[model samples]
Target chain A: MSADAESRWPAVARDYVQAIADTKLLLGQRYGEWMLKGPNLEDDISGASNGQDEIGQVRQLFRLLEKQGVDRDWLETDREPAEYANAQPLDEEAEAWPTFMVQVALSDRAAWLLLDAIRHEDFTGMVQKMGEDEYFHLEHHDARLETLAVDQPEAVEAALERYFPGILAFIGPATYGAGEDPLVEADFTDRAVAEIRGAFREHYVDLFAGTDVTVPALTDDVPDPDEWDEKRRRSGDGHIDQRVADQLQGVTNREYVIE
Target chain B: MSANTAGTGTAGFSIGPEEDADEFEQELWATVDEVPDPHIPVSLVDMAMIYDIEVDAGEVTVTMTYPCMGCPAYDMIQDDVRAVLRTVRGVTDVTIEVTWDPVWSKDMLTDRAREELRDAGIGL
Candidate 1:
């Protein structure tokens, strides 16, 4: 970052941005791992394309934070698993196709909700461009969701139960509003945490309307702000998957990037 | 300046507005516009990828965006822009800034570009 630009950056800028980028980075990892494992060629292609988009988004987001004094290299490769601000749904690999679908859908929606909120005030133009790419991702998720909910409703429900609470905790308790988050105070996003969470809940109200699955209400317990670590979002020593973190650190082939 | 494929002898593609741009800036456009997009047959300028081009002395700053968010061509496009622009006379430095604002869409395609794409059997 230029010295003048660095001087202009506020102190409370990096956490929210890092949280969104980190979540998308892990979500992208899951997509890449399953790109070829999907049941069909088209599904595999969707996974590959969406996964590539996520990596691109992570780069753009990190570049944004770089202006605020965060080192892109440190943010990408050096952070320990606990230093990551990704949502809990991405803590482990998905063992089943249906489970992966629900997990990805929720995780992607949470990230998008954050992006959509920032689009209103975005000056970098990256946010609006990312929203365009995310539009197709959401479409793909909905179509897969419909089929998965009908074919394996039980698995879908189980996956939803597994992931929804983590997202709630990420958004904080149901009482979240502008007063609770520094993001709102910084004007990085136009919506309060609760409003963003509500927008997320509304996404599933009718997603399974015609399917065998019954969508449940988001009654998950929210994290208490008093004990929360705003930078990491979640309040635990819990870390991301070690295997994934190693891949990021390039314990594998040098050709692979942290994305 | 290298006399490679910087200028493909393509037709006029001077920037639409900003008539006040210096002669060097205008020359920079024609030079950089010659580099074809990796995924498309048309030049970058015709594809509406060149958002802004400003020239101060010999230094040039070009703000551009791509049609797809994840297209790996972004890296190539940056390199190509630099290579082509640097080959231009009086050009000493080149800077490329990628933006996603007003995201690239079919509406941004030039008429000539649309025609070329149509001839290529690529749906817009």
Candidate 2:
């Protein structure tokens, strides 16, 4: 409502959009890895279905950004890896399926919370449409997580141990009293984040309750954005490192032509 | 057309097929018809995905195809059909043969199946 809040709205929306896109793209890539490797035929089909759903979710978010005057191609392509705010170095080291699943479960839970907040925020008509699609996507992934936890407890436990610590870092810093960025501060409330985190913790506890695995405690030490920036710069120094990009391309079986 | 007529109905129609054979064929067809497509939740018979159901003595053979070659739900439907047929009485063995010939099309769906698709928001 205030001029300061109005000015910050775009940035906050962009951050939220980036977060959603990152989670979708990451999970989409991960699920695609299980295309023919699922435990059974039914599982193989389920994995592909979930992969399609994640890609669909990404497209929905991209459509929302497009309506906000963001160029579709640039939102998807032109941005440098370092400029990807929600992507972190930790994801690269999640080398196994269980590890990847843990990361997906936690990030998806966070995403559902963030999207729920945005759905209620004052926005244009397009945002509401995209929000409804996102609500269904969240439910789909929630069902998937429950199935994996109940049926594949050991795998879920292993993944949780490998990925839970990075979750706190993934939430990024709290923006209280940090110079007003309307998008970050506008319609943002601590209570919403707390509620979202509470829901996440409940699922987390339920999955890990009877297992030998234990997730590390959430930390107050927020990661510095500059550190992530520097890591990206180092990786992009053109040393012919195509590890992550190559891995993603390999899983999709579609070469990254980048045209 | 009389009650004294042998192997003839009251309407003068001849009962060419044996009663036991006719009853077995009917039972076999019903079992195949009852299997539902797991993803679409419609009876395979209504979808016309089932091409033929043949019963030879104690053996039952079902030939079917999916809406498309790459249909993801194809295997699930096949599994359901197999599971349902295994329960049919007097069926000593059941074999499902998936075929693509006479390829499936929207025309294959029964009128009721088309209405079901429309209700589900999947236009014919």
Candidate 3:
């Protein structure tokens, strides 16, 4: 950590970093659910590959957090559902390809923007490595959107409407009093929520305009901050589905002690 | 002509066999070509990941591309690159730089690699 980070900033920024790390891990878990179950082999390969990329990024962030004195074991395995700091949308099951696409389009891009904001900060090397992965994620999502627009326009539009509000939480509350949030005070993000929301809306519009799909209107899609837990960065009850948890846990059910 | 002191070698070690510049570079590349991709049987050179190789003053730098952007195998591939290339005589330092522009294409694969892929029933 740099002197600027260690000395001048409030402790909340560390929570923010933790939230970002958790979000990446959760997103990787969600993507892992679709590994070989996507609509086609190309999509299957993409899901598997993207899941690996996100997990790789999580490892990098976790290593950084360890350097900053966070406990690695607790972070990886011991946290309760409520203690998880990922965004609410990720808590939902990816039941359909459209739902997954919405996540890739809205939430992933928003997360990418946040990571990109800190690209030149004290964690430049790690952020740059993660950014390289985000580049491919965004590209793959864009390509998938184009495909869905032609094949399943209605489903895509419905997904956009369903998840756009929850995804808005990615940018945080729409407005903040001057010097109110430590995330901004610490220079961790370049834009406030409103600014990011505006830019994201424009980008979202441009993405679907060329096809028959209709982008969801953001006029009344604001997320309720009262529902949001500032510490956990989530707005809903429940963690991941039970099946998902069991599947994840089964990865290393048995281990041998080496003498 | 000079010792490889930049690495873990002990001090005052005698120099190894000498080679002309082109031959030395080819030797480094050959070493690189032998390191297989963890996910695939083919090597980075076979997968079109290696874009260029440069050698100067016993230091080797490789310019590389990912088979796919955000490849999870990035660190492993890079570590393998260093481990393999370091085995070459007279090499002291190894640096691997990644690039994305003009991105990797299947067309860049060597004939042997292409044959391996074809035999495995993998398509471009």
Clash totals for all models, in order? 0, 4, 0
lDDT of 3 by residue, B1-124 (tens): 0110112322332111124447787777778888887877787778777867888898888877665544667787888899888888899999876543334556667788889988888886
Poorest lDDT segment (10 consecutive residues) of candidate 3 chain A: A250-259
Off by over 4 Å in 3: A1-9, A177-181, A210-212, A219-221, A249-259, B1-124
Question: Over the stretch A50-154, how does candidate 1's per-residue lDDT look in tens digits?
Answer: 999998898777876776678876887787777888988888889999999988988898888776666222334566677767888899998999888878889
Model 3 alpha-carbon miss at residue B98, Å: 16
lDDT of 2 by residue, A1-259 (tens): 2244233345555666666666666666666766677556865676676666666556556655665566876666545444444434334535655555566557666655555455322232223333434455455555555667667777766676555544544444333223432333555432234344445667667655665545555443333333322222112222212454445335355565552
Model 2 steric clash pairs: A8-A182, A8-A183, A9-A183, A12-A183
Answer with 1 or 3, whichever has the higher TM-score. Answer: 1
- Compared with the true structure, all predictions reach lDDT values of 0.76, 0.55, 0.68
- DockQ ranking from best to worst? 1, 3, 2
For model 1, the stretches where C-alpha displacement exceeds 4 angstroms are A1-9, A119-124, A209-221, A249-251, A255-259, B1-17
Instruction: Give lDDT tens digits, candidate 1, residues B52-107.
Output: 88777888889887877777877878988999888888889998877665456667
- Residues A1-259 of candidate 3: C-alpha lDDT, one tens digit per residue: 2365344334565666777777777788878777877889988787777788887767666655665678886777665666667766787776889778887657778776666655224454445556667777789898888888888888888888877776676566665323554566666665555666777788878888878778766542365656655666556665666555544444355354232
